[model samples]
Each structure stands twice: as C-alpha cells, then as structure tokens.
Target: MESEINKSPKASAFTLIVAFVCVALVGLALVPLLPVKLNPSRTLPGFTVRFSMPGTSARVVEMTATSKLEAMLARVKGIRGIYSTSGNGWGSISVNLDKHVDAAVARFEASTIIRQTWPELPDGVSYPYIQMQSPGQGSQSPFMTFTINAPATPVLIQRYAEEHIKTRLAQLSGIYKINLSGATPMEWRLEYDSEQLRTLGISTDDIREAVRLHYQKEFMGTYDVEQGASDRQWIRLALVPESESRDFDAGRIQVKMKDGRMIGLNELVKVSRVEEQPQSYYRINGLNSVYLSVVAEETANQLALSKEVKAYMDGIRSQLPAGYEIHTGYDATEFIREELNRIYLRTGVTVAILLLFVLLITFSPEYLFLIVVSLSVNIAIAVIFYYAFGLEMQLYSLAGITVSLNLVIDNTIVMSDHYLRCGNRKVFMSVLAATLTTIGALVIIFFLDEKIRLNLQDFAAVVIINLGVSLLVALFFVPSLIDKIGLERRKRISPSKPKLKL
Candidate 1:
C-alpha cells in the first residue's frame, strides 16, 4: 500500500513542455517587430505663435493684431495659459495644451483659425503665427547646428540649405523635422532712397504708399449680407512683383505722389537684386556655417534609424562641402544599443550559471530541461504582452527584463527540489503545499509592485509570469515525471524468511 501511495499521473510533462516551447518561440519572434526608440530628451513639445510688425510700435501691434489673435486662439481647443512678449513691433502668443492632446493637432487647429482671421488684419501686419513650443530648439531638435555665415550675404546659406541639405537630412527615418534658422540666401533687396525722395519733394510716407499701391490696388473689405453672417473676402487689385526675378524698379511702376509731383519711382530708389542675407549668424567648429537641425519622430526606432541615417550620410559625402562635416549634440543611439547589449550579455551568463547550478543540485538532466522550458516560456509571454500593448522596447524596459534574472530561477528551484524529496504520498502533499505557498507570495508581490514606468516594474512583471508558469508545470506535470523517472533507484525490501534466519 505504501509503495503505491506515491501515485503520479501519466506523462503529461512532455505535453506541457511542448506548449512552453511554442509559446517561447512566438514571444521571441515578436521582439524585433516592436516599435523601438531612444528618446532621451526630457523636453516635451510646446510652441507659440509669433507675429511681427517691423519698424512699427509694439503698442500698435498689440492693440490691433495681438489682442485679436489671442482671443481667436483662446477659442481653439487645447489652451493651458497664454503668455505674450510685445517687443518693438513683435508679439508672441505662447500656448500650452493638455497632456492628452497631440502637438500636431494643436498646431493644425491654431493655423486654421489664424487663416480665417488674416483678412481682418491691416495690409502690412502679418497673419497670426503659430510655431511649436520649443524651449531650446537649437539644442533639442538638431543636437547640433552649423551656421554658414558669409560676412554680409547670409541668403546664400539659406539657399544652399534649402537646395542641398534640408531634403537630404529629412530622408533620415528617425529625424522628425529639419529646420534652417540662420540668414537664408536672399534674392531681392529694395532700399528706399532717402536723398532722391527729398529732391522730389516726396516724403518717405509717399514712397511707402506707392509700394503699397503696387501690392494692393482696390481694398476688398469683408461683405455682410442682410440677416446673414459677414463674409471675409479679398479682391485682387494690383500685380506686385510676382516673382523674385521681377525687379521693382522705377521703369516698371507708375508712382502717383501725395502732392502734385509726378516721378518714375524707380529713379528715386535703388532696386537691384543683390544677395541679401539675414543678420543672424550660425557657427560650427568656431566657423560660421548654415544651421540645420534634426528632430526625432514619434515612432522613430533609434538604433535602426541612426544606422540608416549614417548610411545615408555616407552616401551623400560627395554632396557636403570639403570643409563641412556632420556632428551630434544629442545622439542617444550608441548609448541605448550599448545598454541593451550589456543586458543581453548579462542575461546569457546568468542563465548559464543558473542552469548549471540547478542541474548540479538535482543531478537530473530532465528537470534541467523543464527549468529552461518554463523560463523561456515565461519571458516569451512578457515580450508578446509588450508588443501587443504597442510598448516600445526602450532601455528602461529592457533593464526591467534583465533585472528579473534572479527571480526567474525561483520556481524551477522549488519544483525540482520538492520532486527529488517526494519519497511517498506525504512528500507529494508537502510539495504541493510548498508550491501553493510560493505561488501565493508571488501573486502578492505582483499586485504590490507599481514602478511600471521603468525597469523595475518590467522586471517584476516578467518574474511573476515566469514563476506562475513554473508552478503550474510543477503541479500538473513534474510530479508525474518524478514518479515514473528515477525508477532504477527504488527501495529494496527483505523477505520474511530472512528475518527468521536472523
């Protein structure tokens, strides 16, 4: 009766083992398919709308332009607070959105409202502007920028960037948007002749009016119908310089002065297509250069994106000037790759040592196989879960997986150690109790842990999964395997005749 008391079921361990292998394989396959990124920038997306009325008073711009745009954007979605800087003839409308709102959506909504309001503004006043809330855009987006400065001509830099670099950099997958900031290459520079106008008895205001007439012939005001809403409309009147090539000289324009004076406006001022550059300068390696910045997209895979970016750069080496070179201010690609590899290597070593220790203690190869199967399956489940949730394989997340190494071995130890000690029915019941107790504790830990944002929580999650699966394997399969296995080392009983002879 005692011999048969150690009742173990049929060979179901093999079936569970097969299921574990299938699950593990599926999970491992899901890793590369996940959207991975190396976003180390702590900065969030935020921008403001900027409009300027150059040479005009700040007060005038504020009262007429700034106030109206502010009121309009205030009606658009996603507005936290509005802060403005009314300097000289420029005003900026800073806006912050709720965390849930996407920045791109915010920009679109703001732009649409501004377009509808453009008709109401004075001719010289610009349309209400909206730009991203970038705190240190130079540092954040580009990681590095080189300003191509030509002593007086900056437009060449702008032209070169537009014609050459901007599009090339945009091809890099990880980069979000590349923007050129410094003085761009210019085509037209029309200067007002101060002295020639004085001789003509025409004030500067007269010349300004002449140029204004060239752009706008008949003012088109908004039309309002009876018992209906007003319609914003613009009726084109004059053909200003349609293209940069069309020079605004005295020969082309007919100027009607404020007084009885009549003159060819071109004769009063010099209107020639001179290379015009912005006043701002860009510097790289202590030399002035054209500045271009590269930003990362939402789903940019940092490691792969960088590798592709470098490849693309290599392909365009002939495109860059002899003195020009690429540099990085915020390349987290190499760092992330290194961290991931480190974790992978560590995991490999830890797993090897762990299996070796477990095998040595059990002196059983079969149990070792079970340990490997359970762990592999456990990790596979976690990876699949992550991919299904659309979670990126970030460094912190990988860190969580690596840190789980120690805990992953716990279930295997419990199951294998108990199986070897299960001499009979009492031993089997005790093993079951031990397994249940360990499982209960793991469940408690799983619910209590909450650092899911980083490596800690991820590690815990994997551990909990691995242990739970291991316990299930132990309960449903390992006991049966133990009973059938180790059959050669059975207990030997002496016959009743042997006791009588003694």
Candidate 2:
C-alpha cells in the first residue's frame, strides 16, 4: 500500500477526497431525517401500578388492594424499594428496581405478580394498570395544551373536543397520549321518599340489594334441538335471561317489603338522569372550558410534531360551530424552537471563530481550506454516527457537537502542522495517540449507573465519534491534500540567496 501510494499520490489523494465528499453528502442528506427533541428521553429504573375502586374509602383500598400488590411486587427479584399511596377510591404503587436489572424483564415479572394477586383483591377494585415510569414523567408538562371555549354547555364542549379535536389530533403521527378534561359525566340519580319507604317497611339496604340483583344476568344450560326429522341433525342454542336494560324504567324494578309484599320501585324512589357535579373545574376568561393535553412520543421530533399539530388545528378551526373557539393554553414547542435557534446561532458563531483562528495561525489559504474540509468531513461522519446510534438532535447532543468543533479544529491543525514539520509516520502516531486518549476517558461513561449513563451517553458518544473522525481526516486526508496541492514542497523550498556583488 505504501509503495502504491508513493507511485500514484494523485490517484490516492483523489480517491480519499472523493470518498470524504460522498460521506459528507450522505451526512447532509440525513440531517433532515434525524429525530429532534428538547432533551434526551430516559426510562428510569421504576414501574408504577395504578388501580381504582369506586365508592370505596382510601383505607379499604389500601387494605384490600394496594397492600397485596406491594407485597406481591416485593417478591420479584432486583427490586430496591416499593412505595405506595392510597387515595379516596384509588391507589398507586411504585416499584424501584436495581440499576443492573433489565427493565423489560422486571416489568414482565411485576406484571405477572400483579395478575396473580388480582383475584385476591376486592370485587369493586378495577384491574391494575402497569406502566414504566420514566424520569421526569410525573413533573413533565404536556407537549401542547389546547382549550375549547364556546357558548354551549361544558358537556357539549367536552363531547365536541373528544369527537373532533382529540380524535383528530390523535390520528397524527408521534402523538403518544391525549387527555381530555373539564366536563362531568352523566349519571342516574335516585331519590327515595322516606314516608313511602317506612310505609312499605323497606330499608335502604334492601333497596340497594334489589337494585344490584336486578342488573345481574344469569346464563342457563344450552339446549339442543333437532333441525330436521329426516337428517336427525341437532343445533345447540345458548340460553341467557335478559335481567336488566340500560334504560332505567322505575316500574320495571321491584323492592320486597318486610310484610312480604312486592311494590314497584317507582312508588318508593324517583329516578332521574342528570349530569354529575364537576370534580375539577377549568375556566378561561371567566367561562367554563374543556381542554386536551397532548403528549408526543419520546423519540419524536418536537418541532415537526408541533408544526403538524398546529396545521391540523388550523385546518379544523373553520369547521367548528359558531361561537366555538380553540385557544392555545400552553405550547412547549415554542421553548424548544427558541432553544434550537440559539444552538444554531452558537454553532455558526463557533465555526466562524474557529475559521478566523485557523487563518490567523496558518496565514496560508491552503491550510485554512484543508482545515475547513476536515471540519466538514468530521462533522458529517459524526452525524452519520448519530443516525446509526439512534441519537436525537436534542440539547445535550447538540451541545456535544458544538463543544467538539473546537477539538476538530485542534486535531486538523495539529496534524497539518506536524505533517509539514515532520513526516507521515510521526504525525500519524501523534494524532492516533491523542484521539485514543480522549476516547479512553469518554468510555468511562458507559460503566456508570444506567440512569446516569442514559443521560450522558449521547454527549459522550458524539464527542468520541467526532474525535475519531477528526483523527482519520487528519492522518489520511490532510496529508494527501497537502501532497496534491504541493504545499509541503512550497514550505520546504528555501529562497535562493542572491550573489553579493563586492
């Protein structure tokens, strides 16, 4: 390889330049494809289980549901701690796992334990919902919040938002979750007449039991019937009794009295369907409103997702009914956009400063141009690495790239100077040693705890990749370019001393 290169340095230089140019082109193409976010997404070493038991007190929920779940979850391996909270009619348990444990495996085991313990829970308790608790999930604000205001009732506004706004936004890509609130659900309310109940000698507990039993359906055994006399074929039919209907008719229900008399429930209690009082209220400009909170997927590009959501909302704005309006409650993407703009500005300024410094030091356009090309190729290679590693163009990663710019310039200058002053072998060894030392320090990030590693890994990886690429460019491309441009020969040639005329 050495003899071949010495024989045809131009061909070798051309090949190297073309290869790097192609790499730079490919990296530029991937710029738009990179996923951009405000920060790195990290899954913490924890899992949460939430459950609810309507109409049950917190104490009852703790005793019957939360306690059992915590006890069962504790038996799973790699668990560090189990924390629980019991609220009115609801409960939650958070399980923290050891840093070295595989999150997916731990989640599966925890889920299995929860399912096994489910049957032991009270009948009123709902199924336990398991979810991985990512870092900052509890305090992280929604990506976007939209409020709906109108002249209509809160229920009407909520229904419209649910059917139109929420559903439409959810259909867009990158939407992870949507939550709608600020409206009350409708429920059947029953008012009992004390005098009629006393006269019928029926107690409230009896009425409750009767109502509960009325809704219970019973399934009888299947019956087989002969379809045809000649063929003697039989068809089996399932038997089920229709015990209750969704529509509540007062006369259809009956309460048994202490005197052994059955009376229509309408005589003792009046039933009406009405909207329940709102548990939580939302208001905008002194008017009741409904709002939707949208959360994007962790790996999603926030800028793109935000734009898509806003465009969709604008497209539907005209379709809303008269007096109905959609207002932006809060937009997290605005901050992200501003931060990105700042990063871009800082990057441009940094590149400019580095170029000026290179010119001042080298005073030769050839060296300056070589450094520029090296920087470009180094950055392009780093971008390719980012895409390969599934790293996001976020704050931390961008910061990494920005900080690595200085190092890229440094490597190029060092290699070019040494190559001109010394030769290929010594410069190559020097650059290689420097690059390896920097990488060795960065490799320590991978050995840290998983939580810390996840947060810092992207930064370390970007720096390491940039440095490695810079090394390669400094060793191969820079020297080849120097030989092609004859810069080394120019520097080595000394001006001939003029003959003195005595």
Candidate 3:
C-alpha cells in the first residue's frame, strides 16, 4: 500500500490539495453569512400580559382586570404557574410555561383567550397586550439610544421622531421595539374663570356642551330635491357646514345662561393650544430633549443591526433642520464588537505561538508547513459545519475553535512523526482510534440537563468537527504530501550518513 501511494504521489497530492482548497474557499464564503450573536438561541419559558385602566385604584384593577385575566389564561396548555401584579391604573399577568411546552403555541393560545375574555373586562379596562419573554428579557437593555435636540417644542420633536425616525426604524428588519421619552403631546387647554362664569350664569358643563357642539357634525337626514323633469335626488344635510367644521373658532360658540340669554363662550372661558406635561424627562447637556430607545429582536445579529441603524441615523442627520441635532447616548454593540475582537486577537496570538513553538522543536520547515496546512483545512471544515448546523459565531464557539487549534497541532505532530518512521497504514488506524475516543467523550454532553446542554453544545460541536477533519487530513493528506515532496526519504537518508561514517 505504501509503495502504491508513493508511486502516484504527485497525482494523489494534487487531488487532495485541490479538494482541501475548494473546501477552504467554500468555508470562507459562508463565514460572513453565519449569524453573529452573544450566545446560542434558546426560547424563553414564559410571557407577560399587561392591561391598564386609567384613574382606577389598584384594588379595583385587580378585581376587574388582573383576576379575570389570570383565570382565563390558566386554561392555556402547559401553564406551570400564573403570577400577577396590580398597581395604580394598571395590572400585569405572567404565565410561566413548562420546559417542554412550545412557546409559539402557548403565545397563540394566550392571545386567543385574551380576545375571548375582552368583553368580560371592565368598561374602562384596556385590551390586554401580550409580549413573549425573549431570552435575557429580564435584564435586556436598549441596544441604542438617541437624544433629539431642537429649538422647537418637545411636541414637535416627538412628532418628527415618530413620523420620520421611528417609522423608518420600525420598518427595518430585526427591530423589536422603539420607545420615545420626554414626549409631550399637543393639547387644547380650556381655562374658566369661576367669578366670570357665575356672573354670566354659565356653568362649566354649559361651556363643555358649547365646545362639543362647535366640533360635532350631525347628519340631519336628507332633503329630497327635484332634478330634471320628475327625477328626484336626496341631498345629505349636516348640522355643521363643511366650511365651518374645517376651522375651529371659539368665539363662534355660544353658551345658554341660567336666565335664558346666549353668551359667547370666549367671554367665560379661554381656549389655547398648549403642550401636555411629559410623562418622562430626558436631558442632554442640561437641555431638555426627546430621546428614542431602540430594542433589537431576539435572534438579531446585534453588531450588524447596529451598523444599519447608525447608517440610517447618518442619513437622518443630513436632512435635519439647522437647529436640530441627533446625539447618541449609548451604543451597546460597541461592547459586543470589542469583545469579539478581543477573542479574535487571542486566537491569532495562540496560532502564532504554536507555530513558533513547532518551528523551534522540530527545526523542520517541512513539518511546520504540514502543521499549518492541517490547521487551516480543519478550520475550514469546521466553519462549513457551523453554517450547516446553524451554529453562531459567539464566545463559546470561538473558544472551542481556539482550543481545537492545539488539538490539530497535536494530531499533525503525531502523524508526521510516525509517517517519517514507519510510513504504513498503522499510522492512520492508530490516529483514527484516538480521535474517535475523544469524540465519544464529548458526545455525552448532549444528554445533560437542557440549560447546560444548550450552553455547551456549540463548543462541543466545534471541537468535534475540528478533531474529525484533522484526523482525515493527518492520515491522507499529510502522508501523501510528505511522499510527494520526498521529505520522509530525505530525513531518513540524512540520519543514516552519520551511522555510515562511524
């Protein structure tokens, strides 16, 4: 077998090298397509449903909205426990699902149940809103926050952010939610003077009725109009003309007094457009501002998503008015990017040190070259598997690849040493057996508890793939290439010269 392999060394070496090169090229092509995440994808085991009733006390909210929702949601399959909290004007119900339950199915059932029970809730209670508990939901922060500063009012800034920035960001894929803070809505304030109202014999209710009538449009039936000949048509009639309804004039509204006298509404009440007090406050550089918080989807690639968002913000900045500015308050992706870069730097340093050590010990550039080729081919094969198995390029998996580099070096050393000495099929069999044993040990990880298994699965997979590919490279490609280049023969002959001279 050794003689036959040596006879066609050029052919064998060329074929194997081309095959490995193709594999490397394909793997490099797929590297960019694999998702980059901080951790593996895992479904969270629960979800929350929130409802609100403005101006209602906590006790009333519990009795009316919280209790009813908990009872109705309890019927959902695979529910492990139902927890609830009721506060002033609001309540929330948390449904914890069993580990084996499908989260999607549970969410669908819960939504359907909430809609069915909507009519049973109190009159003022809001429709129950449901949100799935994504991974890290408890401690997840917004990936990006931006403060908008403008010379205009808060209401105007809020409107611009909503209509332009928020709308466009929401349309982007992988954006889970966008929240606006320091948002003040435009409101019409009606100030009434108590003494003036008393003197005019007009009450607040009278003013309210007059204002309502001023904006209200009533359909007062239709008028039968005679057209050409005997043909007749019905014309729709409205209490307020279209022209008058388009513009609001408080002076045109008249309120009836206690003495049956009509007075202008402006005489007793002042109507003015004003900004409502903001629910939340945001400040940048000690100046009041409106800010937006952008949350990423559960499975989104944070680094990629952040890049897209920054590009979008750049475009928005160019179009903003002179006095408007967008300032980034926080960028969470920066940390992730730095962390990944650190890992990459560590991997590169490890490879460099290993190569240096190999060159020092062996003093054989040929052997060092073999080790490099083996490492590269194994890594390429592992990358292909990562893409095929839906593994992410994260901390754990990168650590696995880094550790596997040492294993690749070890396997290459053993194979190269044995091939130079024995050069037989036994070299392949022994290395194959050792590699299989290592894989067997790692396979037990899959049977462990779910939480542990999910965390370590990617790491184990990366190591195992590298080990298997390394074995194939060591057994077939390494020995054939050694024969092709006459490295083995040169080493043996060189050592024999000293013995012959003695």
Candidate 4:
C-alpha cells in the first residue's frame, strides 16, 4: 500500500479526502441526534421504597410500614444490603444489589416484591411509593428553581400554585418533578369549644363521621331498561348528592343527641380555613414566598430546558394577579455550561501551545496544516464513536475528549517529525509502534471491575477510539499528504568544492 501510494501521490491524497469526507458525513448526521445532558450519574443496581401515613407516629411507622417492607425486599434476588429510615408519618427502605445485578431486572423484582407486600401494610397508610434508583445516581438534582412572591396567605399561595402554576409547569416537556415548598397542602380545620362539645354529647369522631358520610361516594350498581331488541343500555348508579356543599363553613351540620334532641354543628364547633401544623415556610429576600423546584428528565438538555421553562414563565407572568411576581433562582444549567466553558477554554489554550511549539520546531506551513488536519480528523471521529455508543456527553466524557486531543496531537507531531527526517517508508512503522504501546496500557481499564472504572468507562472508550483514529491518520493520511505535497524532502546543502588555489 505504501509503495503504491508513493508511486501515485495524487491517488493517495484523493483516498485520504474521500475517507475524511465519509467521517465528516457521519459526524454531521449523528451530532444532532446525540443526547445532551448536564451531568450523567453512574447508576448502580438498587431500589428505594417510600411510604407515607399521615398523623402516624414514628414507632407505628417503623413497626407497621418499615419492618414489613424490609422483610419483603429481603426476598429480592442479589440483595447485598438493606437500609431503612423510619420517621414520623413516613418510612423508606433502600435495597442494594450486587455489582453484577442488572438494574432493570432488579427494579422488576423489587416492584414485584412491593406489590406482594402492599396489602400487608396496616390500614390508613397510603399506597407505597416504590421505585428503582441507582445508589450512585439515585435521583437527578433540581434543574431550576423559582420563588413565587405574592401578597397573599400561605394557603392562598398553595392553592394558586397547585391550581395554576403547577398545572402549567407540568404541561412542559422533559419535566420530571415539580416540588413546592413554603406552601401548605389544603386541609379541613375544625376548632370547637370543649364545654359546648361536652354538653352536646358529641366528639371529634362524631363530627368526622358526619363529614365522611356526606362526602364519600358510593357505588349503587346500575339501572337497566330495554329500549329495543338490539339496543339495551344500562345507566350506572352512584350515590351523588346535588345539594352537597364544597365550602365547609357555609352551612350547619346536624347532630342527633343521645336524648333525641338535635343540635346544629355551628352551635358546637367553628369551621375555618387554616394552615396545617408544621407548615412549609419559604421566604426569599424576606418576603412571603412559595418556592418551586423543577427537576428535568435524565435525557434532557438542561440549558435548553431552562430556556424553554423561562420563556413559558415569561408568557404567563402578565396573567398573574396584582402584587404577585415570579422570581427566578438557582438555575443548575448555568453551572453545567460554566464547567463546559472552562473545559473548552483549557482545550483552546492547549491547542494554542501545541501549535506554537510545532511552529518553533518545523517552521513550515505545510507541516502545520498537516498537523491540524490529522488532529481534527481524529477528534471528529472520536466524537462519532461517543454518539454511536449511545453515551450521553457529560463532564467525564468531555474530559476524555480533552485528553484525546493531546494524544492525537502527540501522534501527529511525532509522525510529522519522523517524515521530515526519514522517508515515508519508515514513518508508518514508527507511528504504529508508538500507537500500539499507548493503546496497550488502556486495554486493562476496560476490563477492570472497580467503581472508578465503571464510572469512567466512557472516558476510556473515548480515549481508545481517538487513539485508534489517530493511528490511522498518522500512518496513512499524514504520510500521504507529505508525499503528495512533496514536503517530506528537506533541502540538503551540498558542500561546495573549495575554489582551486589560484
């Protein structure tokens, strides 16, 4: 191949151009389709179980919710450890799996176990929030935060957020979760005089029963009538009362006394709207506020997602009531973009230094151009490999690209220098030896089972692919250019014969 290329330098140059054009075509096509993310968490095999039972004590939560969940999760396959948290009104369990476990399979198994144990939980506990999560990347952090500052009560803000803001935000694409803080959930409050209740022979339990009887929906089977021989229909029947009131304070409830006298609930208790105890308190710049923390999906572009969210918020701001304003806060994408910018700046500086050093050594424009071409081709090809493998571009992967840049430049400089000294015949052999030695050291990283290696395989993969491309460019493309451009022949100064002594 070398001799043939040496015989027809133009053919070699054409081959190199065609090869790079093919790489460029692939790179351009795949670049837009590649998934972009701020940061990618290295997920391990694990699952989390969350349970909430309002008004329950920690002891009850532990014995009834946590213990039963742990017992069920223990039966899951590849169980390495079980850790749980039992708190007032809530319980959580984390089941860790062996390193060899498949995350998806573990999730399925854990979900099955949760389904089996869900029925065993005591009455009053809400359905358990069961999910699979990686220990390393358990859940993504909030992508953006905004504070709703309004001249309104906490209950009012909570209602508005739930009814208006939350509903709007949930409609946006790529949003995973929207967490509200400093706003209390709506709950019915009943304040009663102890003496009045005692005189009426009524308890809080009686009042609760009355409310449940009025509010609870009941299924009453169906009412069916035959309309025609081929068309008989049944109307579903439900115990829905048209006169039921939504406002708790509007009308009086009736309670039958033990002695057959009836009393109005208004005479016994006062119903009012109030904040729940341990209410969430959110304040920004010393103003009453409700904080919204928006988390984005794992595969989303944090920067682009934030922009879309900002635009939506802006569009809706004019519709807000007087004295209500939305204050944008802590955008996580800024940090991610900042980190990327730093990497880019460092890479630019490294390239500048490499170019300056090469100029000082070779002082030839042709050699400089060849070096740039070789480096660009190899790095571009490396990027194609990154997207081809379904890897999300992240901090570690960017770092790998930075390192790959230096390796490609190194290979280019060495082979270019070798060609300027020796002929093209020796350039390929020398570059092959150097490239093989560098690649051999990285081969072990792909096989290691250590945590760091698992987290860094994308980095190693980038490096290896770039190295391989660098070898191709150094062995073929660079040599072909040097021979075709006739830049490999360094001008030799023939010693002039000393003038005959005359």
- Against the true structure, whose lDDT is highest? 2
How does candidate 3 score on lDDT?
0.73
Measured by C-alpha RMSD in angstroms, how accurate is candidate 1? Answer: 11.3
Candidate 4: lDDT of 366?
Answer: 73
Task: Tell me the tens digit of each residue's lDDT in model 1 across 405-465.
Answer: 5655665456545555543343434545665665565455445522222323434444445
CA displacement after TM-score superposition, residue 496 of candidate 4 (Å): 16
Determine the backbone clash count of candidate 1.
Answer: 17
Q: Per-residue lDDT of 30-136 in model 4, one digit per residue for the tens?
A: 66555556666566567787766767999999998899889888887888789999998888988877778888887777766765675576755644655676644
**Cα TM-score per model:** 0.55, 0.72, 0.68, 0.69
lDDT of 2 by residue, 342-409 (tens): 98899899888878887886677877787787888889877887889888777788888888888888
lDDT scores of the candidates, listed in order: 0.56, 0.74, 0.73, 0.69
Q: Alpha-carbon error at 389 in model 3, in Å?
A: 1.8
Say which prediction, candidate 2 or candidate 4, comes out ahead on lDDT.
2
| Number of the predicted model whose TM-score against the real structure is largest | 2
Cα lDDT tens digits, model 3, 305-341, are 8899999999999998788899998987787788778
Ranking by TM-score: 2, 4, 3, 1
Task: List candidate 4 stretches off by more than 4 Å.
Answer: 1-10, 18-22, 25-33, 53-68, 87-89, 99-127, 134-140, 153-182, 186-279, 285-288, 450-453, 483-502
Off by over 4 Å in 3: 1-11, 53-72, 80-91, 98-105, 112-125, 133-142, 166-278, 286-288, 293-301, 484-502
For model 4, what is the alpha-carbon lDDT of residue 246? 42
- Backbone clash total, candidate 4: 0
Per-prediction RMSD in angstroms? Answer: 11.3, 11.4, 12.4, 11.6
